[model samples]
Target: MQARSVAGEAARNLVTGTTRALWWALAFVVLVGGLAVADARVLVRVWQDADAFRSAGAAVQTLASEREQVVDGTRCQALSGVAGLTGAGALRPGAPVRAASMPSSDLTVWEVTPGVLDLLTTTARPVRTATGTTTGGLWLADDLAAALGASAGDELVIDDGRVRVAGVYTWPDDGRDRVLAYAAVVAVPATGTFERCWAGAWPVDDDAAGLLYSATSPGADDLRLGQLNSTRGSGYDLSGLVDARPTAVAPAAAAAVGLVLGYLAVRTRRLELASALHARVPKPFLTWQHLLEAGCWLAAALSVTAAATGVAALVGSPGPYLGTWATAGMAAGTGAAATLIGTLVGVLTTREKHLFRYFKER
Candidate 1:
């Protein structure tokens, strides 16, 4: 087959030449890998580290009627109501109030379930749970409990509610990972609890089957709406969950820049070959035509290697791995483009031997 001959010649060139192609390839790999690491640590972390997407809701009128909804994970579906905050003041006596059974000691450690917590590692504080309750209580966030200076079995008042320390924990911030630190949790009565209001509520779990909510208007109206029951609405799927598209882009860009440099390095030695073929081939052939072929092949090979290595490293560490095919494809395309541009420059200069000589002299 004609394909076989081309493949054979390409292989021969690789081995026959003692040119610095191998060295250049090694340099390209190092540049790409180093840049990738730096970009991921700095640029990608900036976008992915902070809470970019907000899960919010709005409520119209006072929810007087009893209503309940089950949640699976701490997803937007679990959000009850993004009810407009009517009053801009803190919760005071006689004010309308909403309470969640699963309280969160800290805002970052969003309580998704009774004992489970979810938070980005960059949130600063982590959750710490204690076991074997005593005089006070056991449930507390790591920071809150640490601030109390209480150890296991020690009694203290949190938000006015007496509690006992249990345990401390550190969680990974990677997007896919979930923290199921606590298993069993019981609420402390608000009467003797802290005066804080927001601390008494926590986000619903994404996987929780239902949501439980109660409205209280002290000294105005107190009605027993027995736990309202409601199931999550349909059409709720996690198909669009986990966005690595943005994260993958940065590395792809860096890889592209490296690929361009690689193409230039390769074409430097291939100048004579490209010139010889020019006469045998189409008249006035663009240097870019030959460079394009080399560019595509180089990008294809580099992209595959980068993705495989990136994925392997991500798997071993706490960072997100290349989860989506789109990410890999984008990375590959970026690399290909960079290589093409770099090769084009090199090949174009070869057309003018004078320019090529100037570059060598410089």
Candidate 2:
């Protein structure tokens, strides 16, 4: 009966000691937990954006490759009186037409008809000159503009004539490092038959392909034409920007901070642990006490992290929240690992005999 009373008292004392120790470090725990939650949110958003960007880039690449194959394989001549070709509406009697060709020197020059600019409303807008005049000749992509050392209102020599640099524009696939430029087709010499055409009312019907093939060259089996629809693919890749290095840094730092704090907490209770050990408490019981204490601290930290995450989601934005079970699982796992590691280190370093010797010396 006496032994049972001592065991009960020891267990109660263990709980009280754990509570006192945790109270001293509650502020630290809250601070670390809050930081962890913030990092998790940022990480989740960045990862999602990165994945979306990568998928878009892949789609763009596939489309570009297919377009290249079509352009390389076909020799096409203009077939008059052909209607319903994809983007053929832009060629209405008075409507402007845009023709693109690569004559030489890896340069693609586009000649846009007068009203063609309006049709490109979704593309980057042409910038006006400082003098308030609209640039009237050509719009270059930023990379192309930089390559020529030209800006808005500047003049660039194309086919022996100077064309005004209207402004810079970017395509969605430009994120994949493509070079793009545009100009009034008249500025470029009437080259070999135009290779590609862009119109406002691009066709999406099943018969559109047949219409295009029949329009290019009827009765000529040697010539093949292919259509490239740029509107169907993704536009960007952010994988490089959101790499593993940047994503891992925050969680790693949090784990290290948590481990250090847990270690300190454990060290502070070494004397209590040694006393319990000297009182003939089984090693398993003592180990269980340490683990239980670590678990309590970890649980408290996780609770604070969850609460902070919920509050931020409610007070901040109206979009779908990104936090998931995986995120929570990661945070919990890291916190628990740090706590258990600290507990093991503390127990191993401070022996029961060392505590008794220190007490005798005191």
Candidate 3:
């Protein structure tokens, strides 16, 4: 009860106490809270990018006779087994056909199997402005359409036949499309009878990552995932964003600050503690008083961080704030607690057997 009373009194002293070592410990608590909040904010943005990239980064694979690559039905079946592939398809490629609108325009045509462009080109967020229908015609890229001096209604006369231009889809020509912007998809036969199978998946796909990291024993076939388009992704690091693993940095730094303050709070005041002990004051009371002093300031710092969190949420930050608080706060809290513990431990463990040591040191 004496320790409790002393602690209670010291807790009151914190507000009126001079701003010094204990205040610095409180500052560290504030630092911990701020770090947690910052980490939460950054993680939120990264997750948004991750969700978008999960689809936009994937480009279908290719298997074409033009490359002298032959793929059979049995091999195509393997694509079906891939759990990561959200969409898979087989499209035939025709020889380069000359567009009637622009005689010099050598356009590639794909014999699309009606409706699946989104699934095939998973890794892109281009403004896919599609217009009209091919009615078994071609789907021209908006950019390609401009180049050919053609529109949705106009027919594209090729060597195979006069195909009616259906709709057009405009997406970026980044490595994710795996198709050419200057290409058209028509619903007719191409020169090639065999079709190339493509999968809508990227390396970040959890299905792919799961399979790769499975604890299952060896002898599993390695699924080779590749993209057809060979260009950089749409200005984002699709798979290499660093997470908050280094969040400990802030707390570790706070701990160093706490340690210095703890030294000041305890070592500089040993004589006072000795005088109290001589006056028949219990060592535990002195220890608790110092701890309470530390706690009051640290708790105040935590309060400031909490206030900041409220401000962030009010300003429309989608939170993981609680998570950051727990992570960073716990780390910083331990260090701050250790400061008090270390200070008190010093008092209890000192070799001073009498009040004479205090008087002599003074």
Candidate 4:
């Protein structure tokens, strides 16, 4: 009963004495830590987006640089041989088909096989006819649909054939000025000679190059072959940026806040701690009691920090940034460590003091 009474008295003294300091510490940690976390999250998201944009730009640039070489002449017959050798199966003739009143754009009408839509990235829908067979109609790129003021299920005349717009699609190497439309090979009139052939093959392979060389007509040296090389060495370098500022600032700020709060707490209860020790209180018990007090402050600080982060996420435009688990874990760990350090400092200062001298001076 005596021990219990002593413990209760110590706990009450700790709480009442340090309440103001605890509040100030909690507010400071929450405000600073919340801002740091939010900033880190935003930076990571933006860097990822920027890297993706850069990759897309690189692919477009590679395709544009090589387009002139592969698409030179009006009639390139060797395209069929090139297609067969590169495992693209067969080459189909394609031409630009447009409506009369439509504004001019760089649009190409391609005649493709049945599963060509499956090979390419498209939003095509399968239509089941009366015979129970599924067939694909004309498909337009997103920009092309916008330009024609058309949507899926709308009919548009391409060449002499009226076809339904199946869906909108995007190509990885497609430029802003380029749009593509597709139809079944059987639906379009055969032009006998193909103006261009769309074939898929990695241009860097020696086997592909050898096949392209043999396929070329003896006199048609103008038939050029271009390959898209989007492979890059290294992506974005986030190491330097992440490590430089936040890592140093967060821990330091936490430590500073902890030290100040801890000093204030110790100063307020100096006499109480002295009295308790002089009353035959065990050093370990006193230390544990002070630790419990520090823990309460630490818990409040963490709760406030969490709430602040959540509120920032809810109200901020573009939303609050959430970083990796490691980043968040490190931040929490640092705060805890700083708080513990501050608590130990206070405890040790009390243990080493000369209680009799303190009373004599008083």
Q: Please, what is the TM-score per model?
A: 0.43, 0.44, 0.55, 0.57
lDDT (tens digit, per residue) of candidate 2 on 56-170: 2222111112222122112211211234321221111112322222234444555433323432333333443323433256666665666667787776665546667666654
Q: What's the lDDT of the predicted structure labeled candidate 4?
A: 0.48
Q: Candidates' lDDT values, in order?
A: 0.37, 0.46, 0.54, 0.48
lDDT per residue (tens digit) for residues 100-190 in model 1: 3224433222222221222211221334444543223344434334554555556654344554444444322323112222222223222
Rank list by TM-score:
4, 3, 2, 1
Looking at candidate 2, the ten consecutive residues that score lowest on lDDT are 86-95
| Superior candidate under lDDT, 3 versus 4 | 3
Question: Best-fitting candidate, measured by lDDT?
Answer: 3
Tens digit per residue, CA lDDT, model 3, 26-55: 556455556656654555555455555554
Q: After superposition, how far is residue 132 of candidate 4 from its true place, in Å?
A: 18
Error of 4 at 97 (Å): 1.7
Q: Worst lDDT window (10 residues) for model 3?
A: 209-218
**All predictions: root-mean-square deviation over Cα?**
12.6, 13.0, 8.3, 9.4
lDDT of 1 at 147: 51
Better model by lDDT: candidate 2 vs candidate 3 = 3
